[model samples]
Target chain A: MSQLKLNTEGMKPIYVQIAEWLETEILSASIKSDEKIYSQYQLAEMFNINPATAAKGLNILADEKILYKKRGLGMFVSPKAKESIQEKRKNQILKNLVLELVTEAGRLGVDENELISMIKTSNKFVGGRDHERN
Target chain B: MNVIESRGLTKTYGNLKAVNNLSFDIEENKVTGLIGRNGAGKTTLLKLIAGFLHKTSGEIEVFSDNPFNSIKVSSNMIFIDDKMSFPASLHLVDILEAAGNFYDNWDAGLANGLIDYFNLNPRQPHSSLSKGMKSAFNMIIGLSARCPLTIYDEPTTGMDVAVRKDFYRALLKDYLQNPRTIIISSHLLNEVEHVLEDILLLREGQKCMHMPVEELKELAICLKGKAGIIQELATGKEIYHKENIGKDSAYVVVKNDFTEDRLQNVKLSGVEITPVATDELCVFLTSRNKGGIDDVFDRN
Candidate 1:
């Protein structure tokens, strides 16, 4: 759980980074659906950030319906939290990275066919590696 | 609700105005960083709020009463600085006991725990401690006081890196338990930015920008690309800092008001955009000129 070392130098704000990190934890199944999540105070202490900032991060997830509050108990991950997070990341994170890859390829005089082949090779290599580990 | 409010607060030191017509409100239960360069009237403004100095003109209110020499304000507020000194005759532990009697919300247990944690020798007098130890002691008091309005002006002056880190964590943890209006004045925003909810930036005794810390991170963005493209794109936009990267490339910081599509287009045009860090953005905003120190070097 100590993997929350934030990139203070990155272009993304800390709260957004926190929200993304929690989504990542959920996606990785470290936190399961209907399970209690870290409170704002806990996040603040863990990250050495302002409680308000941590609260803001939690509120973002809550607003997205990935988390729901249970009165005084605290926030719990939604049952569909993983699916929603996956959908959001597909539309946002994966798309942005792909866009960057394509743009860089275009700048380097990489044709669409060559770019597609490179992506296919990379995907196969990564998939085979993961399968081997499994 | 606003825990502190100043209307055109002005404090003049004979021919010089240390605080000039500053008007801002600090909401309760929020940590605000009073950030500025040296001689930027940060201390003067904090003093005015702490009721140690009187303003030449204008008005400042703490808890709806004038803060100047007000008994009500003094009891409810704690101001910690490097210059804070306890009675010469009192031992460190004795001073803690006295403080316990003074503030209604004093947490003796927390104070003792922090004392043991820092390994502070309570038997020694305040003056006998090292600079770093003295600062740690002052911070201990500042935190244990649990005042409604806590003002810390560079409370980490002599602290080492580890001590500073622990101090910030302790401050944040305590604040979570007992929310209050805390103003931490520091020139180094990078160190304190994450700990702050809001930032009240000052420049030359005037308010520069006051906003949430998150919004300030997105206030401007740095763009690096071909000189022609960057210059053309920056036209009619508010440029905070600009410089020639090499011969054909230029780097410019401009207001981040671009739509997603425009930003995408800028990327397509080969312009790299990076978010301006809080400290760097403050430097750009408070810089006297767009050229900065390079202006002095580039007299061609």
Candidate 2:
């Protein structure tokens, strides 16, 4: 029952937003394994999208094995969806952050080693014990 | 995925065939532009897809199912026309309330925000709003409803350039936040050309061309220069449209290879060569008394 809101002012497609929202819900374990998620029609009516558009988002999840259809019933959250979703989301975020850092470094004439040093210095200044060193 | 599939889709109004055996597939997660002249049957085809009109003969599939009277299918699709008429006496807020009830995904916050952005007073009667305001109201519903497949027919008809640009900007912004299959039917081709992933060109109710924007760009080029030089360089080539202004002549459209070396040669020959805009290309393609299709293909 995650309240997935759409920003008509943004440039992303509604389907992608819906997919991201569903992924977030799955990762948070808000939608449990084998839970009967809303059907494409229901989702469409709920979101004011054409059912086909909603189906596209659902299909993306289904393709990733995060959701599965029960045939004549409805789509359900996959048993391993939460774990898979978490792994996928984490990898995606890291990749995006790395890309951003690389791009910024290119712009600012800074190297990866400098970035790594900055991270270490910042961690030290936070005054947290180095658990990695132990 | 093929959200909409049509085969030999034809529509006739007495002697005029608005859509003549049209066939095209609207894919998922892409913005498809429906472009045509005033009587080009763009609206007819859209209405046909929306199940508001029955086709004379042919097949149309929405989500692997016929869209006509299919509650599940139709419920997912929303069609916002240019002339969105609410009751004459109904207040703007009342109309929005009705819209919310009609659309399950209607975002009241988004609607209210849009109303404020447009400076529309909710207490104003629907009949009292200007043409531009009415269009804005319809646009708000189309965007805020978040419908998966939303078809907008001439959404910016009477608006000023500034307002039209605002609508496009808002549309792009909304699109980034929520991706859906949006079909925008408009005569203002130059305005919406960039926003479209693909374009459907209709002429006399027939699909004249259905292709990606990049492909279409590659297919046509504009050549301009001194009349004599341009004519010499364009010899034996298919000219889509040509205009001569005194000593300087410009062909707004032509079919040419447009390769770097070839284009350089044309330029060196004192002819200016550039790619034709989608709008200019459409006008050129649909112009009556133009050469045959083979003539267009022979330019290579």
Write one digit per residue (lDDT tens) for candidate 1, span B1-300.
998999999999989999999999999999999999889999999999999999999989999999987999999999999999788888999999999999999999999999999999889899899999999999999999999999999999999999998898789889988999999999888888888999999999999999999999988999999999999989999989888977999999999999988998898888899988889889888886656777788798
DockQ, Cα level, model 2: 0.02
Over A1-134, each residue of candidate 2 has an lDDT whose tens digit, in order, gives 33235653332455667788788877777788999887765665555444556776798899998999888898999899888877987787676666656666766898879988987898786655565555
Query: For each candidate, what TM-score against the reference?
Result: 0.96, 0.65
User: Candidate 1's error at B35, in angstroms?
Assistant: 0.4
Give the lowest summed-lDDT range of ten residues in model 1 chain A.
A1-10
Quantify all predictions' global Cα lDDT against the true fold.
0.93, 0.79
lDDT of 2 by residue, B116-232 (tens): 988999999989988888888888889888887888999997777988877876776577568888999998887776556688999988888998754665677777777777777
Residue B44 in candidate 1, Cα distance off native in Å: 0.5
**How well does model 2 score by local distance difference test?**
0.79
- Tell the DockQ for candidate 1: 0.78
Residue pairs whose backbone atoms clash in candidate 1: none
* Candidate 2 docking classification: incorrect
